[model samples]
Target: MSNAINVKRAAVASLMDQLRADVTEKKLTPQEELAILEKLKVYGRTVAGSDAIYSSEGIIFLAEVASRPDNPDSSREALRCLANALYLDRQTVQYFIDAGYVEKASEAYKSENVDDEFLLGRILFFSTTFSKDDKLLDKWVNEHHLVENNIAAIARHATAYATAASTASSQAVSMMQTMALQDTLKLLYTLTTKLPDVSTTLGPTIPHLLSLLSSIPLQSSPLQPPTHHVLDALSNIPPTTPDSQASYFPTSDPTLHVSKILKILDKAAIPATSATSSRSTTADDFDSRAASLLKLLIEIYPPSPDVVKQLIRDTLLPSEKERSLPLGSQNSATLPARLLRLASSPTTTNTRIILQTLLFVISDEDPVKFVKNVGYGHASGYLMMRGIPIPSEALEEIAAESGEEGGSGKRINPITGQYLDDELKAMEASNVKGLEGMTDEEKEQEAEKLFVLFERLNRTGVINVENPVRTAMQEGRFEEIKSDNEDSDDDDNEAGKGKGKAKA
Candidate 1:
């Protein structure tokens, strides 16, 4: 078995060497280059099954080729071989880290030129994915301008991708252009989401992203996926206060911050109210992207209750309530209603969490207020669609089994009961007093808020609203978001304050 593995590894090594030689000597023509890459990519999978492959010299050889200057096509192929080899293998990730692949790849990425956009993007993408600890990431985030560099690379590649894709008459070139755009956007998404305080990193790219987002025609197949990621990346960029403190459940401004974002959002939202609405992936993708774009827009500007309410109401109630079209038929739901329904779930697909966070914060957990203020019928419809508990008559109806009428039996939810008990216990331990001097109606009104209602209801089933900080952390939000102020005390402690006097 060991000898067989060694032979296979040798075969892979020889293949890598030949590819490198071809690139170095400029021996391979474009057609030959592509053909060889296809062979390497296919061969990579066959040999990837061997544990010995990762430790062999071939792996490093590929990394060097990938990082080599002025060979974008070959570089991409080299990177793709490694990616295919490493896909879903923990051993591959660990071996890459231990063998210093991350550092080497980072160096290559740092030295890469504009033409090496796809190659550079993959380097940053894979390196970050394989980084076992914060040592490298800290260096990039703190001292090195990785965020700045990444945005530049993305913008450069995107402009090229857009241009090539638009003008290229050849199907192959167009396909390559599509792949390039998708990869670039995905890389940007990975960078911003993984890096802390990333919104600040995207200042230069936002205008370009806004322009791209605005240009995407509704349900346009060629553009949606890449455009989708651009919006996804934007939403994932955390909102920040002037002091760099993370905004927890940030608000949306009435104007949606920039006029461009607002306009793009309007364009994207067009599909939600189209004549054909079946909630398919294309539709869902557009809806989700639109929701995420709205989230980023809202978080940038302080949210207005009126604006949110109007947004929901517009979705809930169409311009003509008594239309001739069949109910819930083609494009029955307006943009806000479609997005509201989508946002009710804390699913990652649609930036629903961001929208949910904004709404929950602004609504303050009152379902009744959300209905009365936002669009009672529409809001209720959205909640019911999600099966989220509302803690009112609407709640009973939502929780009740469909088609079962007449009995007034309360829904028995053991999980919800346990959660409420946990909340009560927490409140008692904190010695907080509430509902003592309140009437039932006042208490009901208080319970009706969207914020309170979400706490009681688990739309995503992954969140415990009473412990939002922990929930947020589990969802990969930065711990810094948990704090309103930077840990100046910790810095002071590090600098020696109360424990010992500082030397002048």
Candidate 2:
């Protein structure tokens, strides 16, 4: 009896497995598929243990099953399954759309009670896959109405889909279809006005979309309505506030949104001359725009040396006159200084420009005086080591001026020997004044001692020089003379003795 019960349980499990496979393959007849779908929906809601079965393949199967009859009710069920499947695997939904499953997907998207997840998935699928199908997009747009919630949904959809499609061929197509300059501008305006939170929530996505639109090359014609619209939209975004919007800067990736904007500007063909303007405008307008964009960039992104160097080279270098203008002028040095501070920062990639600028400022004036008086003495040591050439003409002029002065008529000492009589007297007086605090008795005693020492030296006619070795050498010379005299007497005595002996 136990073996029979086990067999019955195994048979029921096998039947359920077969039924699931049938649903996945869409092999059921329309009526049968509908009934199974209803059961699956119930299972999806209550089969507390079978949630893991809703794979991408399962959703594709269900979407296929619903499309079999092309009826509204079936389409709704198919969309729900597809939505659940997408929640599981977005790539799978994209795959289905690529395989020409878009029409069926759109049918399901039209459900009145569609969840945000389902709506978002369908919008992405449609924007990415059927980007060129403006009629379909228009139909959805018209039916959805231009309400904030709908627009927000569309914005979110555009942003999310664009992020995913960034690398796909669909990016170009999607930009061409849904993201014209005008539409992007309008969308951005609406987004910024209604959803200020977008700066934080869709931080990376908004710039990417803007970059794609910006990249489209503009024609030579006067500012078109669409061009103006895009410009206006860009202008509307508040200049990036450092505290709240710091994360919007381009990342380290080479394929960043800012790069895309640069490429777009490169492709654009601005008019050579405008009718309303008398001045011949080159690419300065674009450069100004680029600079403005970079201003926000510097505020949001940590300053990088490369970014700073590029700003100097690209923005400040070209407009030297503007950069050098007086402080209050339209083109003043303030902006350039701010940019240089950012680019020439110690942490930046290129610090040579900063060093060079400092050197130039130092060298422009009388550098010696500047170094001596301006607390730049440390810099002087560096300058000397760096072998900066002192101007030969300046050296010659200094020599010539010095030559005009008369030389001193008398010179005695190479070391402290040139004092005049009055100078020596003044030095003695100062030394005497230094002892003024001594008692009168001490002063008289010092004077009397000096007088006695000089008198004794005069009487002896001796200075009593302190060198003992020299005194000993002089005494020894005198002793040698006296001994020679004694030796002469002894020689005489010896000679007399020799004569006497000869007489005898």
Candidate 3:
């Protein structure tokens, strides 16, 4: 028995040396390091020692190994160990945090390898939220003092995950993408919420955020990864703070337009998805958060008067489904068209909030311009749905004199859209451009191109744009629509518990 014990101790010593070399210096391959880790894990469970992975040096080696730039596979393995230690040994974890391991891992998280990205993000998630060394984070931010926010590390990984999710072929890849996204969001949320003063990180993070949001599917299921956190971080960020300045609307021309982002949000919130392919709960949370951000954005940057026509052109007219509808039909199916759709629906109170935003944006232009361009029916109907009173001045222009007394200035019929003859004529005149000479198939194709116009010229609804009434319809009246993927919330809660559970 004594001879057998001596042999096992010798083997353990050799394995420990290998592990130490792997962490202290880049002397071992990824495979070698993993093998050592496995051996140490098995031995450490059976025997307690001052130099084992459960000790201070063990954590130091793991943190150093995690931030390695040469071998991401090894780095990821090391990160997993550190994250486990995050919940196991607070004294060791704090020593690591104070040594700046959290920030170093954060910077390394920008790794091109998706696996490395996931692990690094997990490190940030636990370290910032669970370990939560605020002093370390503050000092780290000061050390890497950026003149501008350079969150490219996290941003690149975020964009990479989104891009990969689009082309993922296998279920494993899909799951990885899901995890990568959720982990990144969690880390970002923790940073913004816990260290709101860390503006250097958030500055470069904004553009990538917009890019990611622009790519999300509309109507995501609530079971998907809670995407709402992104919006929460954005909405909570102080706009004037230095950290907030990086995301601020450019003061100069060619700036990030309010209408531009609104259009992106419009597409994301309502993106057409195939019926068979299910949306996850995280996606639904994202949509909710996105809508909230949209509310904040609309409040800060209502569409610019200079770009009003462009907003209508890009968002309402040329979108995918809107194209198939007749120009008259297209009019009522647009962004403005949907505003009426939502406001009239009993399902949500976002209507009141959305209505006020639309009113403020369109308020800059004359109603007649909208009537002639988008058709009086669509524009007027949307105003009516929001309970805003129609302006008599604009109404007079669309309604021809009945010439009969008490004929209540000819209201457009709501169902058939019949009333705006003059506006329809004007719309058709501009619409008939290429068809001035084409015929047969040529005219057919030309007509298809003109799908950008409203569905029907004849339509009825209130024409009110002046001094609109604003109300937050969802306020106290609505609850979030629940999703079928409630298990995800349970799973996430379980994961959170893993972080806060008692140390070993």
Which sequence of candidate numbers ranks them by lDDT, best first? Answer: 1, 3, 2
Candidate number achieving the greatest lDDT relative to the actual structure: 1
| lDDT tens digits by residue: candidate 2, 162-237 | 5545554544433333333233345444444443344443344344335434443344532333444444444345
Alpha-carbon lDDT, every model: 0.50, 0.38, 0.49
Clashes of each: 17, 4, 27
lDDT of 1 at 223: 25
Q: For residue 261, give model 2's deviation from the true position in Å.
A: 4.1
TM per candidate comes to 0.54, 0.26, 0.45
lDDT digits (tens) for residues 20-115 of candidate 1: 687569787766766666676776676543343455465666666666656577777777777766664545655655666665555455443443
Q: How well does candidate 1 score on lDDT at residue 69?
A: 55
Quote the lDDT for 350 in model 1: 54
Candidate 1 has its poorest 10 consecutive residues by lDDT at 495-504
RMSD of each: 19.2, 28.9, 19.7
